[model samples]
Target: MAKQLIFKTKYTEHLKEAVSSGKSLEFYKSKEFVYDKKQVLIMPNIEAFPNLTSSLDIKDDFKTAVQIYEAFKGLEPIQASDERFWTYLAHVDLFLYMIERWPEVYVGKSSNPSKYLLDHWFISSSAQSSLLRHAISGLWWSVYLSVDEAKGENKYGLTKILFRQLDFPTRTLGTYKLGRHKEAVLGILEFIQENEDLFKTKFEDKTRFVTKHLNVVGGVKPIAYYDRQFFKSELEKVSGNISAI
Candidate 1:
């Protein structure tokens, strides 16, 4: 059994205790959090993930991330209010597990949790970059979006295209406008994948462009009712107007 702490009842209360020390690198291995031997299970088989992160597609890895997300899906950690979500991610050893697997994650090998892991794993604001912010949550959301995109009409998986471009996930995934809606997610990715040449170098906030157009067209008709052609035309319209704005 790995040495670590876990929450039994009060998540927030336990989180306070864990961060109270504000420790890092060495903190990960130290005797602090009361390891209950029954905390929420983290994503298994992460040995290949560090190398996988280097791959822009992350499709296979994203699938693995989904497996992790399902573990927490209806569980208290993710089922609770959005704000308290971090409490579970941080306490769950998602950070420590990574560090232990790859000590390289430690910024300076300083063994200080606050210095290296805290900022990325524990964020207060869900900004545009939040999709890539906290380590574990970011993985889950990325998988969520990518899974939706794969379900769309496009035969070529967009995970490779979208994950490679930071512009896609950062500007859009955290927002309720498109990220929360499967139809919008699939439509936009298909639009982008089909128009690769048009946006090869002209891209700037492509995700936002898709969301903006979705709102406009969706207002006129149900987004789910729109076909592939509609997604293409509306995205083109939005892309054309982006330069004016």
Candidate 2:
């Protein structure tokens, strides 16, 4: 029989009671939104063995924990033939995939470069560091992939969606605020990537015009109104004048 591992936080019994009584969200949000730099971290554990060739160096535990937790929350606990098989691959694969696929998902190293680092995951200096990092990376990658200067969406409406998505970080489109929007963004990115050269040339040539439109749309605060006709027209104008410089 495979051993079942249950997870728990080090929060005290009183904190747990308060959390269970619906006070956790406030604490969570407060801690997340207003935190100091000199705070201790709390995360999952990593079991890394030394590779004799490279000597003994510790790996990141926080990242491994978050990835595993995120994946688990996404995948859930499964009663498989082998328990170890269920977790080991899922944990490693989750982190590797996030790091490799998303340009914005950065894994930080220890401050002391000379130290043999073991912890992969790090608590942000502030309470909101985790949320901020995740949000920034997601927005950057999404914007990088979706904004097509060549085939600009109908009035930069697409751009507005991305930025608003960043600002709100809500869960309307099946993505929680500051969480991954893997499939939707992936689809858009794939389309943009396939036409990289074409789009790049267009964006570069009409930098001022394209940037103007982007700023206007982004600067529109809440982005309450988006005119499709304007987006289509601007995109067309920019697209037509691009050259492979």
Best model number under TM-score: 1
lDDT of each: 0.50, 0.31
**Please, what are the lDDT tens digits per residue for candidate 2 over residues 15-112?**
33443454432322221222222322222232332121122112422233233332333222122112232222212222333333221213233233
TM-score for all models, in order of appearance: 0.57, 0.27
> How many clashing residue pairs appear in each of the predictions shown?
8, 10
TM-score, prediction 2? 0.27
RMSD of 1: 7.0
Where model 2 places Cα greater than 4 Å from the true spot, the runs are: 1-120, 123-197, 200-213, 220-224, 227-233, 240-245
lDDT of 1 by residue, 1-245 (tens): 23222233355445544554653344455423344455443433222122222222223444545555544444342432243445444544354444443344344454555545455445445553554555556656655555543346542265545555544554454454555555556666677777676566646555566566677666777666655566667777766665543
Error of 1 at 173 (Å): 3.6
Q: How many pairs of residues collide in model 2?
A: 10
